[model samples]
Target: MLIDSHTNLHGETYAEDLDAVIERAREANVSGMIAICCRLSDFEEVSAIAERYDNIWCTIGAHPHHAKDRPDITPDELVEIARHPKVIGIGETGLDFHYGYSPREEQFRSLRAHVEAARRIDLPLILHTRDADDEMADFLESEMEQGAFRALLHCYTGGSALAKRAAKLGAYFAASGIITFKKAEDVRQVFRNDIPEDRIIIETDCPYLAPVPHRGRRNEPSYLPDVLTGVCETLGWTPDEGEAKTTEAFFRLFSKAERPS
Candidate 1:
């Protein structure tokens, strides 16, 4: 069995035939998935998808790209939305200097709010960081000082320094299809040499970052095995071993999720 710890199944990209997409994933042995909601407005749709699928879960929060628009979002609001049983995580939130879709200050503020919400509800924070390693690491370290909160740095392609620091703070690192790219040997090296075995997990981040052989095409959960193959090769684990370890890490971090029988 394989679990796609992060996915955007509710995205418009899958609207035409979401059921077919899901069936394909199941056929590929993707036993579970987390449909992430990067915008509060989309949480209802995302949550509905999770509600309809026993093996699927969802999260509620604004992405860094939308932080400026939803700058007033508070921890209380996040906690309220997270109260739903299908809501198993708090965010796909963090700083993203690569796009600057939102101001850095707003992104930082939003991330702090998400951290507080996750701490309050005792759910993992699904983080997204890009081109802001120094500030991102500093923010994480500062938050850790305030209080510990469970978190996973999803689709990580950050600096070695940040990876080491996050590992020290008990943050899990998710490997995405990016690791399968030819130029991403540096990222593979980090997984192989830096991140601890138990700290690793795999995700498709589907409708985006499709692995090779499917590169330049729309990504989906069914393509997760390609990521698993890359991870297994990098960590020197067989497919079954990698699946067991990553699935274990997924449930460990997102403890609210129900394991499939």
Candidate 2:
């Protein structure tokens, strides 16, 4: 089954047609989706959507872009919120040096709290990193040494070195709509060569990186098949093989989510 492993179904993007967007995704054969939360302030909206649907589950924790807004947030607070039945994962958190929307130190502080929460809760840490592969790689390696926690580098676009290192640490990698771009061969290469085959999954990062043929348009979970097609082409797998492999990896990482009967 197809699962959109990362999404931003909350907020203004989906406000007008949230129901239509979800129905379209279901029509596209998407079996489930993990609605990702990037801000504590946005958790109400995020979790509300998850609660509204049987096939949707949500994650908690802040994105690094807003790290400065809540730098001192502790693992206890995250673990507390994560007790909600629909809150099955611990972040869309990690460093995003490209935007520098938040300072590096604040990002580090917030990410550490998320890691600890994931470790404490036994939930997968959903990470987003851009233009700071070395810092992210180093941070993940060091924290993992402190203790083990599951992680998925959602919408991965980093260099191969980080993928290689993180793979050895059992971190999963997500290929997003980015893989369908003309200039994203590097990303596709990581899917095919760097990340362990069993650890590769897929996402739309919707309202953002919509795949090709629909690039530049707003993304939604309904567009995930294009991303899956791109991944299949990259890995030299047929559509059926890609579907089974990526879906398997997704369920494995987001273990708290149950596949619908």
State each model's CA lDDT, in order.
0.92, 0.92
Write down the TM-score of every candidate.
0.98, 0.98
Estimate, for each residue in 146-212, the C-alpha lDDT of model 1 and write its tens digit. 9999989999898789899889999999999998999999998888777889989999999899998
Per-residue lDDT value at 191 in model 1: 86
On lDDT, the candidate that comes out on top is 1
lDDT of 2 at 155: 91
Q: What is the lDDT of residue 178 in candidate 1?
A: 94
| Model 1 ranges with Cα > 4 A deviation | none
Per candidate, the number of residue pairs that clash is 0, 0
Model 1's alpha-carbon lDDT is 0.92
